[model samples]
Target: MKPGRYIIPKGTYRLTDKLYLTKNTKIIMDKGARLLRDHNAGFFINGRTGDSFTGYDGNGNITIEGGTLDGNLTARYKHYNAIGLARGQNIVIRDVEIIDVRGAHAMDINGCKDVLIEGCKFKGYDINYTVDGDGASYMREAIQIANHTEAGFNSFGSFDAQVCENVTVRDCYFGASANNPAYPAGVGNHGAVADLYMKNIRIYDNIFDGMTYAGVRPYKFENTLIRNNTFINCDYGIRYSNPNGNGTYDAGKAQSGRNTVIQGNNFIRSKIRDIYIVGWVKDGITARVKNIQILDNIFEGVSNAETMYLSFCEDVLIRGNISNITSRFVMGYYSINVSVKDNLVNGITNEVVYVSDATADGSTSYVGLGYTKDYYISGNRVENCGRSAFNMSGLDGVEVHSNVIVNASTETVGTRSAIVATASTRNGHNNKVRGGLWIKSRTFLNEFTVDDYLRKEVKLIVAKYTK
Candidate 1:
């Protein structure tokens, strides 16, 4: 292992181990350099006769400074990751341009910590097929952090799941179509590796677009933070996937996340579900265990997005966010101890907030209430919503306070109040509205209408607070 600079000449180089890599090695690919991957071109050689690049895991103080890693994606191969890091620490990869990678992730963060992937450009192959290899892998995410059992990787294996910790993706460019139109995703959680969860991953200050999926989609993660990013014209701003991220995980099971935060981001013209938080079902108590927060974000041209489609969560918070042309502000279902407050929302076709899992009919095919309760919606300024400003049903101990609504009634909503709540046909309830105001009327509009929408249910609630 040498500590020296191996300069890649400016030419079309085939990716292999002979090019140069070792402990304390700084292999600099000359600008205008292009590489073709007939096989796995690793960031670091995997010892003797290692054909692929492992990208320095279980090692330390390694840096891969610059290069254009062009995986000749037109063809197919096996056993390759655009970059793989396992058991490595203090690794830095910056100013690298990776293009047309097929059959695997652009980067793999496995059982590593203190890694930084910055100033990088990642674009995945345009095809939809899982090219080659020993498994059902594809050219999927720009970065992947997952845990897989040894048995999952090979036939006869011996090991638990690996854990990735403290990895950061900053100032990178993800397949934004305004530039390349078909860029790939930013990052994804393949699933629990070796039956273990990832810990402490950070995604910050990146520009993402053209992501067929999302800027960042995670699973089985802990204390994850995604902040200060800009997303433009993508299918999903932040998918927050409920099922397995890519659905190809053979690694045991995918666990639910904890203490996740999505803050200070901007999403524009996203086609669906801007901030979708579908919490997974964990073992033990089926209680609402919402430990997520979404704050201070801007969303525009929300088209078909639910804006914030949260479900099966508790103790969640959505505050200080602004939206334009957004469909629904919040569709909180099976949620408890939640709060949606102090936001400005404008939409054209739906209710600004609908906390319903229990409707007059059974729950709609789209929403089913299962003990939905303990929510607070307050101080939000909503307008142009076709349905009522707020609609709640099948609830207990919910509060709607001081929300200012304007232009919220539709022709289809004739004689309906601005804020409506009905007890689910199944659950008896205590839901309240206090200081709720119609902005045009300047006072609390007894627009509070109680109803028996669910097949002859008794009432919307048992009481209300009068000023």
Candidate 2:
């Protein structure tokens, strides 16, 4: 099988048992009509881009093993997508590199199920390399899995679309570098940045670098998992927003934004907050965000000026994270039922935790705005922390115990106490101290622990003298 190009005509069902291409080839779709009508089963394009292929309404399973899809592959003739699987099932695109796509998405899986994309690389079209105002900014994403909205009301045009369900991406890279500064004007606000949205999707062991906006955004999804991915120099690493436009907080409501987990990912030198929760923009209203768990991540040399901000959320947990040389580890407003525990916070000049008022309306007066409850702060070490180690001004029901706090070297006085409650004061027992002076209660006017220690030492000396 020598390498060559393979072209499928429009509105045709091209099925092959084993069609192989040895050299570079271009599979061109003839103009003035649709291309790749029903390539349902067993069509393979191998080798380089000596040619190109266009697919439209390509039903059934079509696999592009390895090649470069030169131009755009559309579904219904509107510069929409590079590859479209309309009403198709069990599509697999693996071990392929797609580049130079202009004004369209790299891969679009609409109304499809059991789709898998593994070991594939997608790069958007380069606007800078092209003549000014001549080329479109490569604004679309590497891969998009979504429902077809145009398929009017139960007519069943595009429904139940699974972009990458049971999908695994390993050792792959995706990038878009057009650099358009102007605000994008479109119907769904397209051409903003390179973004990927999925459901029941798993993105692991992949590297996303140099993106203008978010690297991966899984919106309005359920049972979606993102783990062990490295994001380098991205504007935002990963974002989860509300699918419903209504911004309401109801504990009695059903689990919304439920069971979403982001764990064990490394974010290096992010320009903005590594993880962002962008929900409820319309008059500060959004659907309830609950049951989110962030655990066991490493953030090194991240600027505190912008890092790890969450808003309008509830029932969230953040644990076992190491934040070094950063301004603030976590900042939240109007949140509820959140717990932060067992994280090492070091080398910061600002308050470790900052909670703000909900609004002038005082809607947060019930537990008080910024009030965190059922919080367990234990078994963590904090060194050289500035201002205060743990600052809970307006929060309540927060229990702090068994933490090591070391003050900065420039301070003439050590820290006032291990834990300081700014708003209203409550103290817990069994907090140990070492290598610093302690302040006694005004009524007692004594160091109880130090006095007990001296009494024991003096008794031992007198016993030695009598002997």
Candidate 3:
């Protein structure tokens, strides 16, 4: 047992093999115990249960509790990693502090199941941008669960294949600098996986505060639940990045997970988009998330970013949430079969929930605003919005009804419209906005408006079809 305040002195330690911790093994470090790495070592512990990458014998019943693995960032570092788990089962890492990790992940739960990381603290890794001269910032996520190997961070091409299942990260403190002088802080939790599928990952009740990157960046997975978390002033909250790390969007190329539930989370002063959505970069693919239910969330005083953002998505439901001080809650490009209902949006300085077919890169040969279709925005309450209550640029079968939209902006000239179906693209057809109380209204050809002044208490505004 390495006693308290032990120093892993300055030397070449790659000659040491990893600590193979398996069945019913418990390694408990006492208080104030520490492992200070003088060089950037490969991994602190390795749990490779299988001989090959294609299978796993399932290493089980491992518990590592309470110690500080401190990657002395000031040292001439070594390889990039902390703890790499290969195909493990029932691993519980509790009350351990992984700090100054400087290179790669704190816990690389690769091909694992039933892993729990709770009551720990993580900070000051590659976020400060001191690498091994390769310019590769490997320590992107504080705790990343991926299908990659014990090696550094690698994305999927055509040949990558693995899966992680039943992982839970709860009651942890994750903080990176909001403004690191050398490097921008990395994402709190990241998934840059492709081809492979993950299942039953639940991240709840954690505090992600003051990160420059995203709070939870889910690239692709399945059956994931992120609930009851608190995000304070992160760059982006619950966002996504490049779909498959490639340009094109094919199911075989890359795909987001189906069956995700993001609900009951709180966001305070997030810098960028609070509820972010990322699709394929250049090519038009499906949404990064499908069959998603985002419900009962609260966004307070979100500054300078869109409160909610959606891009290429289908079969999604955003309901029963409240957001205020929003910039623009816009959904652009190739969003299909979405429903935004029964939500309260207040003090929206930009579009409450606008729809466009504009991709991120704007090089959508097959993926453009013309392809965004079949969204139902109904039963929502909007108040004090600068732009239109509904800006309908998303094409085909768009229905906006039964909503209260109050356009109260300081500059009221180009503001008070129930819907703005512009003549920009051919996306101005077959859309309808009806039965909403708009304090004012506007008129476009395909962007029609229905203001039912006959209703004494409410003004119903509906716009359908343009010439």
Candidate 4:
């Protein structure tokens, strides 16, 4: 039914199956107002201000178009999503701005299907003063997706049981103030602006800034694609994990989280690490991570703490990226079947790559073989590094060939090793070190070339390394 030119006053509950607000009319769900059981319908709080609408046990679909939902919405106690397809199908929330909900989630989708959230702005309330020890607190997140259970809904029971499918979030903006008290004191433990747990998801072309946590967190699902997003002044740009107890979490799971792709994004001024891939081990056996590709991205002015941290995975590829002004590029522990190539690191302070068989506890305890075979590090460039440009410790069957290293020196002595191979039991060969000024003993069995650029590419190949 159409309610033409009506205003939902403050502190009132507008309950209906399908209620439509006419164009240019106002429906205000003022401070402390609620709406319940809007089943299989649509509501247009069209072009209004100071209108608040809350849904309880609401199902099917609801649309808040071109207006402001300026109050709190509570789906924590209800059994359905606060917005979009709550135990229903095909919901859409477009062109709305929601704000000033203290410690409340913006939207929740439970067992919903084919949901789309576009052109929306979700933000937390601003906080000015902090109570010293009690950091800052505001509205939690913009959107959440999970499944239903009997153990008193909204608790998010098991990672496996919460099955959300075919979700899309595009062209959205998520922002929180930096002065919020809940901001982390150090790196590696910040909160995200949005958390997503679903299958067959596509998140693209969004802008996320001033968030205390990760920009996007995808947990326990597959065939997910995160591309063309901008993350600024946040802690972690994106984090992918498998919270379920499955031995394999790729784009091939029952929900298809097995083959995930993160490509063509920008991460700038991140307070902590930019990207993280965490695998939860069960029964003393590590999970297999396959077909995870990170390609064609730019990481500029990233924090010096850590950039890319990978743990317990196989068949991972990191290629065609550019990093500037970073402390470390990649740190791997207990990783297998990995390839890092065709990347540029300019003005790096620490080692470009640190690989070890050692876990946190330095023992001869080999959890598994530290194998880096059939690996290639080619067509990369490093300039003005503070420490060793390349440090490989305790690696097997590795190759560091056809790379250019230039101007690796500091003020304090320039004694840094250009390429330090510590206790390497494998063959290190065919490495052409370009440019002048070489450090470390040149007693290793490898070919070295010092070519003149004016001689072109033909005569220089026969002149430098052969002599």
Candidate 5:
């Protein structure tokens, strides 16, 4: 490939081997043009001319626009990575249709930067099972943003563990094809390094429908913005994880990153959760995901499902959202400094705002460790909840005030209230409630106030001085 513009005419061309693209190259395909993969090789390989370039400075300044890149349903998991790129910069891919990827990702952005993928369509993929089998595959993403860590996957450029940063994917459509279903995941990081992290990733104005997994899922990423997207009938709209490197290759490294904002998205009939954030705490090493802001989103048909779920998080804010979830609206576990305010929650099956740690994993260790505290739930209009409007348990220093609740605990059998505070240190004031308020301590014997311990320590010091 030379450093010029190559216009492909309007026809279908068969690709027998990997189409290598060098730097400063632009391949523009006309409408009705198609590059059909005929072999197991990758459709396009960026950088690395005959094993000459092999580092972070492999290639850059490449653009591909228009036409369709058809994988032709090649064999599954044979390392057929279409549009494979590694350690490249200033890459732009626009208005292309990528369909029927075999086993790997349709686009692999491994350790790349300054990349923009816009106005594209990513549909169809092959699973790892036969028709009789379960049709499930482990590696699934239309666009995978990863570091150059795994040699088997990131075999293009240098495996120097570079993070993919400054990337944007917008105005895209990810759905099913004529042959197979949609991609399991839209854009994410499947293989995460220990200390490496992706930053400044923006995904917006996209439509994700019927995905088996999350529409946008990122692991070990920071400074990410996922906004104004439409997700329909997916398992999760957005799933973020900051997993502790406990059992993986880097056992002691904790990949803890922060600062993610998910706003103005529309989630319709998501199967599991609209927004899910999960962190980890293993062997006393914690990967705490913090500073997340979820604001002004619309969620519909969230029946029998969690609208938002957060685990092992801190400094989180969920505000100004409208939802009609018939199940739990917002559930937080083993988290701290969480604030949920100014949201209109309607027709909830359980508590509209529930934060506790009594049974996160059916263990009381998290509660005893005091990892759940400083939760503020206020200024929300909650209506028609089958259970309490605000349920607080196994938490410390929780304040619920200035909230309006109507028609709560309607389907309760007995001994339930619109506001239930059990076995936790709580304070409620200035709340306009239409139903009952029940505040009690379930673990009275084990409930030791902070003042009690401070007074006991003072008495012990006096006794020792007198002795």
Candidate 6:
């Protein structure tokens, strides 16, 4: 209990056990300090207490400030885990108040390096749901940046899978706790070990509310930086993946570790996707997720999902965003060098930028198909589109230019197409749009349409996709 500073004075202690911090420890709690664990035992702050070190080389410069650790686990179900830290280095939890967490993680940060969680407030989360079998606690996470697993029992001493480097979660406040629900991931990492990764993760200015799953999930991470966060109703606000990475097309995998940067976030009303980047290849793998960057974000009110969903990625970048989505704002699949730039969309019920390459038939080995090549849609600014704004298909070096559509063809009765291009393979120039550009020419087994669209202004707005 002593390597230096203590302070703790100002109230209710109650903790039946645990609370073993060591090595240059510094706990300062005054503003009504609280600490209440008081029963159904286990951790309140027991990273296997002190140092008899093993893996990740134990006992770091610990520091916990301003208290309230209350894992009252709401009604019962308490398999434990409130503030468990495994291996460590310069750790510092600030302005704390971690509440009601049950069935794991309110802050389990195993194999840590320079960690710093600031202005904390993580609220209640009691969903054991009889512990989902192999999926373990299913999703659970208030702030678990782990490695050194046992499905994140986090190997307190031995398990050398160590890796949780330079983490930094800032200005926190994840919600939910009038009695459970809301923490299926606020900051994550659920198992992954292929050249052990986790490095330089930095989630900024957080506020995630109602996170039933992913407000920031980055497994096997490396140089991640989800900036300026504020997701509400998350169902996947940022679920960047790397489950052992894609070994080309998933055979003894190992590749996801590159620069990830979802910048300036604000996503609201997201119940499905508000930035979900996955990369688990198939159809003879080889994309394996590369440098991704979705910048200048600000999406609002999109429920059926899709305000950003890039899968099986390669060098990608969707820039300067500002959307008011109704559906698909940027959905690229089986990607390659993708670059949708200068965005400013509004109420698009269909394509505001939908690139594709893999809806099967890439020579048919199936899994998830695969084929997109270099794409570059530029200077976007669509408005009220009910169908096409730029809905490309399988490609080869394509480039849609200077976009600026408005009141796009209300629906598809006479197809007012603002650039549809189905079997993609060409360079579209100066796209300004009052509607006029369809192009369906495939030629693999004959599909031929080759440009046709002339239904001067109709209006319905139903939306299904593909034509």
Determine the backbone clash count of candidate 6.
3
Relative to the true structure, how large is the alpha-carbon lDDT of every model?
0.63, 0.49, 0.63, 0.54, 0.78, 0.72
**Model 4: per-residue lDDT, tens digit, 176-275?**
5332222221111112112234567777888877666677766555677888888887777776555434322222222113577888989887777777
TM-score: model 5 vs. ground truth: 0.88
Residue pairs of candidate 5 with colliding backbone atoms: 326-349
Instruction: Output the number of the TM-score-best candidate.
Output: 5
All candidates in order of TM-score, best leading: 5, 3, 1, 4, 2, 6
In order, what is each prediction's RMSD in angstroms? Answer: 7.5, 11.2, 6.5, 9.0, 9.9, 15.4
Off by over 4 Å in 4: 1-62, 72-85, 125-141, 150-152, 155-162, 177-197, 244-257, 359-368, 371-374, 409-413, 424-467
What tens-digit string does per-residue lDDT give for candidate 2 at 333-400?
55666667778877755555554434325655434533344344565656655555555545544455
Worst 10 residues of 2 by lDDT: 185-194
Off by over 4 Å in 1: 1-3, 9-11, 16-21, 40-57, 75-79, 130-139, 151-158, 176-184, 193-195, 242-254, 282-284, 287-289, 358-370, 411-415, 425-467
How many backbone overlaps does candidate 5 show?
Answer: 1
Can you write out model 5's per-residue Cα lDDT over 269-310, one digit (the tens) per residue?
Answer: 999888889888877876789899999999995668889998
Model 6, 64-150: lDDT tens per residue? 888887776543356677778877789898998877777677888877789899998888776546553335465777888877655
lDDT of 1 by residue, 410-442 (tens): 536445556766534122223334333322221
The per-residue C-alpha lDDT of model 2 at residue 378 equals 60
lDDT of 5: 0.78
lDDT of 2 at 86: 45
Candidate 3, residue 321: lDDT = 91
TM for candidate 1 is 0.79
TM-score, one value per model: 0.79, 0.64, 0.80, 0.69, 0.88, 0.41
What are the runs in model 5 whose C-alpha is more than 4 Å off? 49-56, 74-79, 130-136, 247-249, 413-415, 426-467
Answer with 1 or 2, whichever has the higher lDDT.
1
Of the two candidates 5 and 6, the one with more favorable lDDT, higher being better, is: 5
lDDT of 3 by residue, 1-467 (tens): 22122233333333233455545666776767776666545434534333443344445577788777666566645545677666667888898777666556677667778889898877655543442534535326777777644333332111243567888889887875332211123323344454666678888998888666677766576778889998888777787543555523234455666777989999888898787765654344444557878899998755468777776677889899999887865555567788889999887777777776654466545434356777777888776677677776536666666676654342474445555554443433333445443423222443544544523334322121111
